[model samples]
Target: MDWDKLRIFHAVADAGSLTHAGESLHLSQSAVSRQIRALEESLNTTLFRRHARGLILTEQGELLFEATRTMTKRLDATAARIRDSEDEVFGELRVTTTLGFGTLWLLPRLPRLFALYPNLKIDLMLEEKLLDLPMREADVAIRMKEPSQAELIRRRLMDVRICFYANADYVARNGMPETAEALADHRLITQSPSSPQVRAGLEFSQPFVAAANHSAMTVNTYFGILQGVIHGIGIGSLPDYVTADFPDLVRVLPDVQSATIPVYLAYVEELRHSKRVCAFRDFVLEEIQSFRRRALPEAPETGHAMTP
Candidate 1:
């Protein structure tokens, strides 16, 4: 089994089309097909069932895929470990962020980073889904979560203070609640993972517990929830940064208290001391610290900076 040839075949199998795999590998369709044929001939087994639409893996290919995928991941990680020698922060850096942040923040400002570090390559992945870092799916993940794991190097970048908000029309129509207890009159929209400690900290005395059971519509995504609230479906707890910037939303209960959601920037420690990784870490920390300092409404000056 030639390792490189096997790798090409693996790409073809995963992509389901030789042309797609070729595009990914920066090779042509004929070259990839020849490599696949050579690999099958050497193994003396049929790997793919050819079809007009695309290729389907045979039982042999399935068995091979299970091993190949793992090997590819290991190979990628090993390569990163080896490439750690490049002290200039050169080569591709894969990063992932949430949709709203990606749209309003990261994507717009990425050009500055590019201008600052011309040598470092960046691949910014924008999805609401959190990516696995250690597997090399993404080198970094920005998420709203309390950091608990050991394998990751977690840094609490900011406390995403969330408060209830509604459109001005909705607030005007329903009237504003004076206290947390009075919020039951308005439709309350919220999400879970609100630990007991957080609720206690917020002094959430609101009796809108019915909102938990009879939510207008249950959505798993923050963007959808925000849209629902913006359209007058209900009142939603939006991040202060988002609310502070969003023109259409208005904070209804600014005094009732808000839940502080810990935002974390996490990465696999496998490349902890690597020069490129270190360069990226330092750059991200510097950028985020500045962003949090300048942007966050309640950010403290000193201890508020996310410590390692």
Candidate 2:
């Protein structure tokens, strides 16, 4: 019934694991368990059915979740309203992104963000795997592919162009490709293999000759892959924005045969009205828009135009 208990309940419901929910709330596993137990006892119903992975909500828990969600939203709105009156942006903002984007783009820009809002703290979570924002692992997410559903809010920040790049040494030794079809001639470094259809985020028209994991001089991290490409290790398909600063890593070919990717800034419906969330969201959008304008002068004229 209390705000704290409801918050813990929501966390348990979302994370489905004590350890994860505890990490999100900055509480110990025992503390989280106690809170949830107290909450269920107060409610006089079996809210959760504990399992090996975590706890699943019972039918009553599911029903109560609807009301709890509404209550939490209103409570957050009230807090935000008070903070606005006080003229302070103070809260924890959980953000998620991929390895490359997280290391290359976001990590460097965080100092400026802290200077802008001294009271606000940021929790950055990076995963190769996708995260569900509505479930509360992340407050904001930057994803590559287009959002599947129309219900979620998404703003395309950039028309991400992809092409092959490699270090000067690798290119000098193995040689560079003149066309997209010519990439087959050289050695290629990659991270972990994806689905049978996708390899290193590229779907080859023909077949690829060879690949490597981390040990094969193939790395998965953005910085790692970029370093390999810079050192002339091997060629790999990478986002143009990712390799823009590294002069050592040059594009293999000028042609844009690789798939067009989008960099998106998205959040959950629950945080639509949150001041801290919206402030950061709007700031990122403004910055990205300026970057897009500078980077893609003829974006509309070209086939790489972004959709509304």
Candidate 3:
């Protein structure tokens, strides 16, 4: 019931030590202990179990801690939104995207963004799992497919195609496959079909995996597959975007390509006017335009859109 007690409890639960929590809160250890004891008495439950190591949360404490954690996240979100009202594009912007795209494409281009907004703090969360933007899991997302979340402001970014490529040395040794059927002769490297990936990419590799009698080296992330290909492990099914940076990768079966996977940038409707979000959106748009010009000269320009 007491806000201050809840705050102290959250800190103690987080740090798992009275002294540590006290140091962070700028309180004496005895004061923190007294508050914890009083809060436990108020709640009529044992919140923590003290031992020689540190404090361990009781079942009740775990439940209370979860509530306090949510409260903290909401508070942080509010503070971030309040900070966004200022005339500067500064503060933390949590960005989430697939590991492949984040590392291969976005990470490489981040220096330009940092150059423009030195005060900007970016927390890039790279994974295949889609985070809930509306729930404040992340501030923004760049997904291979359009996000299905409601109340999101989505903008179509670009299309990616899964195509076969191999290192120049590997191609020189194994020779390029002229047809889909010819791929049986060479080792294949790719993301596992069961891994979380764009449908188009998985579908593209299916036939090759079957042709190789499931002998392909499958990895969970595109970066792993890229490394395998780079080391001459095998011809890899990779997104076409890699060609811009990895020129040494020779395209195999040039006529064979996966259906285009649409990439989309999305954020909660609430963040539509956030300066940090605007700066990031604009930076990505500019970089996408530049990328098209350099890497995909023939790809038509697709302007940004505000779709549900």
Candidate 4:
């Protein structure tokens, strides 16, 4: 019922010590302890269990902490929204995407974004795990597959395919594979089948593994595979988007490729009017468009539409 007491309790529970919470909140430890006691009396239940080390949350305290955590996030979101100006794009924007795409594609292009909005802060989260947008785990996402989350405003960015590639020197040294069967003589660099990756990419890479007789290297992220290929280790299975920046990589066994993986950009519906979200969405869309235009002619002919 008391907002200040609830805030103090949340802090104390978070730190597991009244002294630590008090230091953070600019209050004396005794004052924080008194507030917690008052809150426990108000709720008619024990909120914490004190021991020689620190306080542990009682069952009731756990429930209240969960509520307060959610409240804190929602309040932070509200404050962020309030701080955003219609004409100025500033403040933190959390973006989530697969590690491969984040490192290979998006991260390199972020300088242009910063050039436009010098004050903007970007928290780039690169992982295979999909973050929950609606729950505020991440403010935006660029995913290989269409997002199934509700209350999300999503846009189709482009279609990407997994293709075999090798550095020019490696190709010159080892010779290019003309057919899937020819891959038997070359060392293959690829994401391990056991690693977390798109089903389509895994399915596409299976035949190559089955065909390879030479030694192979398996890495969890596409970035590692690219590195292996760059250093003349082996031919790698890589996304087509890499060609724009890594122009020296020669497309090998062009006919052997994966089905199109649709890339999507999505954000929570609540962020529809948020200027930062709009700016980021537009910037990504523009970048994708530019990439498609520049890379299309040089892109190996898979005899399929690569654009959305």
Top candidate by lDDT:
3
lDDT of 4 by residue, 1-308 (tens): 99999999989999999999999999999999999999999999999998889999999999999999888878878887887755799999999999999999999999999999998999999999999888888899999988997578888788899999999999888898887888988999889999999999999988778878899889999999999999999999999999989988899987788999988888887777788988898898788878977886654433232221
C-alpha lDDT (0 to 100) for residue 180 of candidate 1: 66
Give candidate 2's error at residue 4 in angstroms. Answer: 7.8
Clashes of each: 0, 3, 0, 0
Say which prediction, candidate 1 or candidate 4, comes out ahead on TM-score. Answer: 4
Cα-based lDDT at residue 236, candidate 1: 77
Q: Compose the digit string of candidate 2's lDDT tens values, residues 114-212.
A: 888899888888776777665565677888766675556776777665566777777677677786556756656554454221232555322343532
Winner by lDDT between candidate 3 and candidate 1: 3
lDDT of 1 by residue, 68-147 (tens): 98788778767877787765657777778776566655666677777777887877897756677766688877776744
- What is the lDDT for 35 in model 3? 98
Indicate the residue-level lDDT of 128 in model 4: 91
What range of 10 consecutive residues in model 3 has the weakest lDDT sum?
299-308
Name model 3 segments beyond 4 Å from true. Answer: 51-53, 213-215
Residues 172-227, model 3: lDDT tens digits: 88787888888988889989877899888888888788878425799988999999
Candidate No. with top TM-score: 3
